[model samples]
Target: MENKIKLLYMLQTLDLKLMDLEEEKGDLPGIVQNLNDQINELQAQIDELRKQINEHTSTREQSNLDAETLNQRVESLKKQLYEVRNNKEYDAITKEIAEAEENIMAKMQNAEEHDDKQKELSANVDELKQKYESLQSELQDNQKDLQEVSKVHEDEELQLKHERDKIARQLPQETLVSYDRIRSAKYGKAVVPITRGACGGCYKTVPPQLNLLLRKNDEILHCENCGRILIAEEIAAEVNKVA
Candidate 1:
């Protein structure tokens, strides 16, 4: 039981050290993450706008071609008017010319509408591209800053995490889960040594009987006030000495 208590304390120690190392990096990690998300969103928007522009351009081109074909047909019909032998034939040729001209006008209008849409989409895409570039530059700078901070603590952090993992593996799964839960609730302090006959974590006075039992270090214990795992002064001394 004493060994278990010591191992838990050791794990807590390593966890605290790792937390401090992470704190040294400041908010660079979060900033880098946010920048990446924004970049991706901007990229998606740019790609979609570009797609719309391409579609509009294709539609305009096809409409212009259709209008040209109808104009050629109208010219052919006009020439056929001269060869008409009767009023009926002359009327039929003129009627064909009128229908072709109407179709040509409709195709031209369709082409102009698509052209306007294409221009508007192109402008929106260009603006999004500029914003994407700016965000990319900012992300690079923040990443560089994060890299600098990480380089300084890389080895130390790795060692501490390795030690923590080793100690945690030696503890029972239930015990480790309890410790982690308490640590999260207590703001990263799961284990504390009894100090001055009081709970070190909450500064609450300890009952005399409970104090006597803590000195035995025979079983794991917790402070009644804060619910943090408690370590006797002697156990803490032993662990610290070994550390």
Candidate 2:
């Protein structure tokens, strides 16, 4: 292999490693965001449950007040019955008393139902609070792990970047520019292999002559269709063996 070709091969290996490291690090932020989202969802559920309990309790309280007032009105009507001036007045009082008694019964039934609903809602809120506490603890633990992973990867990321920069410097400016463009176009995989007369990246067929030229490793070669640098099958097999 020519010296420049060897350098390119070395650069390719380094480039692949750098890509792996960067891709791994990129997912950390998302992991952190997901953890935060889970925590927020749990807290929101707890808050919603508490609000439900509060509304139920308020309804129950209002029902109780109305029932109390209706009872007072029924008592007042019963007292007025003793002072009726005529048959018509007595009949009127009796009707008023019956209506007030019915209103009290209805209010009592509503109060009882409201009490039961409040109890059910309160229990539900308590259960949700317990779950929210557990989720909070879990989120704390996940955040700690995320921080530790970030710290560890920071050093590994710096070393990979340094190595990548060193390899980039060894190539000609024109080659590096071309590599950058291809890396951008090919999703960070600028160098690929030619295997069985096929482009490894795009899986497009290469001519037999081009495949032969790739095997020699005497000059820089690219897949005509994808424009990605192509390594020979022999080199790839050796890499696979070592790996």
Candidate 3:
């Protein structure tokens, strides 16, 4: 009975260590994925800004061409005004010249506005690219750190798991099943020692008769309140000494 109790304790300790190792590894994958997602999103924004800049540049060029065409039309109308045959023809040429001048002014204004928008879009793209590069560097560093940590813990976790399996194999089938069930239900504590004539798991006082039986270590005992396997304090001390 003493040996069985000690084996359970050892198994529990190994299982707890394995759980801790798993927890350490669990968050790394998600963190890496989130970083990659951020980098991708930033890159997309950069691309969109670049596209907008291209569109604005094309529109600006078209406006400039339109302004040039209207200016040429105004010059031709002025030449025609000098050759007009009468006041009616002179007034018609003047009216045409006025309309062309107005169009030229409107096109030049539109081109200037497009130029300003293009500059703004280009600046935005540059800023987004810089942010993307910084995020990429951060992601690489995180990946390297995660790799180092995994390499360090892999062997230790494997050895602990092997030790836990060996100890479990040495325990009785019924006892092993009960221990696993209770450990799962009780957050990884299946066996507990009596402390101050009370259940160590639940901190409830044990009856005098039950406490006396627990101290004997002749038979497997369980705490009635929490259903955890009970071991005598002396038995726990002896196990620790041997370890």
Q: How far is 91's C-alpha from truth in model 2 (Å)? A: 2.1
Between prediction 2 and prediction 3, which has the larger TM-score?
Answer: 2
Better candidate by TM-score, 1 or 2? 1
- Candidate 2, poorest ten consecutive residues by summed lDDT: 1-10
| Tens digits of lDDT, candidate 3, 1-243 | 337777887777788888888788778877889999998888888888888898999999999999999888888888888798999999988988888888888999999999999998888888888888888988998899889888989899889888888888888999888988999999988888889988989999878898787665556678989999888788777766654
> Against the true structure, what is each candidate's TM-score?
0.82, 0.60, 0.56
lDDT of 1 by residue, 1-243 (tens): 437777888888888888999999999999999999999999888888888888999999999999999999998888888888999999988888889899999999999999999998888888888899899999999999999999999999989888888787788999999999999999899999889888889999888888888776557788999998888878888888887
lDDT of all predictions, in order shown? 0.88, 0.75, 0.85
Q: Clash pairs of candidate 1?
A: none
Candidate 2 per-residue lDDT, tens place, 1-243, comes to 234555566666767776776566566567667767877886787788678767867776787788788788878878988998899999998898788778778877887887788788777778867877776776777678667766876877687678767766777898878877888898877777776678889999989998887666567788889898887776766655643
The worst-scoring run of ten residues by lDDT in candidate 3 lies at: 211-220
Where in model 3 is the C-alpha error above 4 Å? 1-20, 153-243
True-vs-predicted CA distance for residue 113, candidate 3, Å = 0.6
Clashing pairs for model 2 are none
